[model samples]
Target: MIMRPPGKSARALLAATLLAPALATAQDAQGQNVTLELNAVEQVDEACRISFLIQNGHDTDIAQAVYEAVLFDTEGRVDRMTLFDFGALPAARPRVRQFVVPGMACTALGRLLINGADTCTGDGVAPDACVRDLTLRSRAEGVEVMG
Candidate 1:
């Protein structure tokens, strides 16, 4: 027997199913937001590695996040910045991620700034997530000047 084509309602249902994950990836639980915090910076060889803590203040779990961290030199100029893409940062307990900038040393940087977030989502992050006002905290232990 030949299979019949799916009806209008069936087609609509199929489309929704295919698009659910994309729509669900940007929503937060009860409108609660997530923020990024710079935890530590270290230099290994010729590269500098910056670690951050992603806090999901919402009740729901987060699946993906994109953020940029800006590094300021001793002269108060933008030394280097890197965009970080995170995966499955759970809610409540903070998650940590590290970003590396090659041919750089931590000794020359003054501070790390959480410049902006591209997107962050529990269900689905809003289009304005990047523009939303958020706080940044720096917990750098100490820095040493390299010879």
Candidate 2:
């Protein structure tokens, strides 16, 4: 049997199929926002270990991402304020970072507030890129996360 060229509709379909992924990737890079989720909190030794799952959806990798965080006690009083340094977050990737607060217990915490991004530096990244369109989430029970 001799092979023949594909018809117009078939060619169009093939082209669309080939370009769909690239188009979707472009759209995703343009519309995606950084997501930070409070993944877990547990007691480790005499300290409280807090975990964060952060997804970098931008097109550039983050060399250093630091956020000012405030921890509140169960009575709504400010327990502590510190900076969480999530180093080297690649684009379109999710990273988990853990911090241990000495002499603190997980059960004593009521809420974690992300005050702002102290530093978000990377190639092709804006000064406020990390916090401008950030989406916050929490999966830890008995603790609330807020921007």
Candidate 3:
């Protein structure tokens, strides 16, 4: 049996295999989706203050993004539903938005649901871009966030 060096095609295949992960990472970044995190929850002046950390990972700037948010009580029952306006999300930028729900205690919050995108407008953004492929996370204790 005789063994020889790899041919040009084999070398090319090896190079592609080595670069596959990097290419995939770059492609993912370019087509990344919006990420929303429940950053904090607190009580202020007899109200529940909800803070959200949002990052626009898309390639286009978002002029306006409003979601229909539903808040669940500690018993896992829907407490209230409201609109959250996350305005002007520039691409690759992270922003924080806070909303205060009057007459609600922070401890009463169990889950936060993103029902859907009520308003999603941008130059190159699709009609369902905001809700489509959305990434949701929760950093606040005792609170679960889901889309």
Candidate 4:
């Protein structure tokens, strides 16, 4: 049998094929898929205001989503923790929520950790549960998504 090394095109194709599933997972993790984006964290006078966007990817409407976020300092130590309680984040619509933390600033943050959804009840009468089966696309750049 004759053997030959893969060329550039072949290597590219092989790499793409191998990374397809990982790329899709990066875009949207398994289980209940949703996208959470950090909008801005700014220091307003004496308080810090953190804003983020949450987009629902399910067919059912999300009535409320409560999460606890932990902020780490530059020394990789726990700095502070806050709760983000959002209401009525409907399907296919992105909802923005802002929370203010006193005596805190964005500069003091080294990493953010989402500690999972405490409450993820769907909208309408007798809504479905959406918290038990949720996956997170944790980039780990500065935030770790634990869902």
- Among these predicted structures, which one has the highest TM-score? 2
Q: Please say which candidate is ahead in TM-score: 3 or 4.
A: 3
- The local distance difference test score of each candidate is 0.67, 0.92, 0.93, 0.69
Which residue runs does candidate 3 get wrong by more than 4 Å? 1-30
Q: How many clashes show up per model?
A: 7, 0, 0, 0
lDDT of 1 by residue, 60-124 (tens): 56677777667678677877667778777676567888877788878887866666666666575
Clashing pairs in 3: none
Candidate 1 — what's its lDDT?
A: 0.67
* Predicted structure with the largest lDDT when compared to the true one: 3
Prediction 3 TM-score vs. true: 0.81
Off by over 4 Å in 2: 1-30
TM per candidate: 0.64, 0.82, 0.81, 0.64
Which structure is stronger by lDDT: 1 or 3?
Answer: 3
Better of 2 and 4 by TM-score: 2
Better of 1 and 2 by lDDT: 2
* True lDDT of residue 142, candidate 2: 92
**Superposed Cα deviation of residue 27, candidate 3 (Å):** 6.5
Name the lDDT value of residue 93 in candidate 2.
88
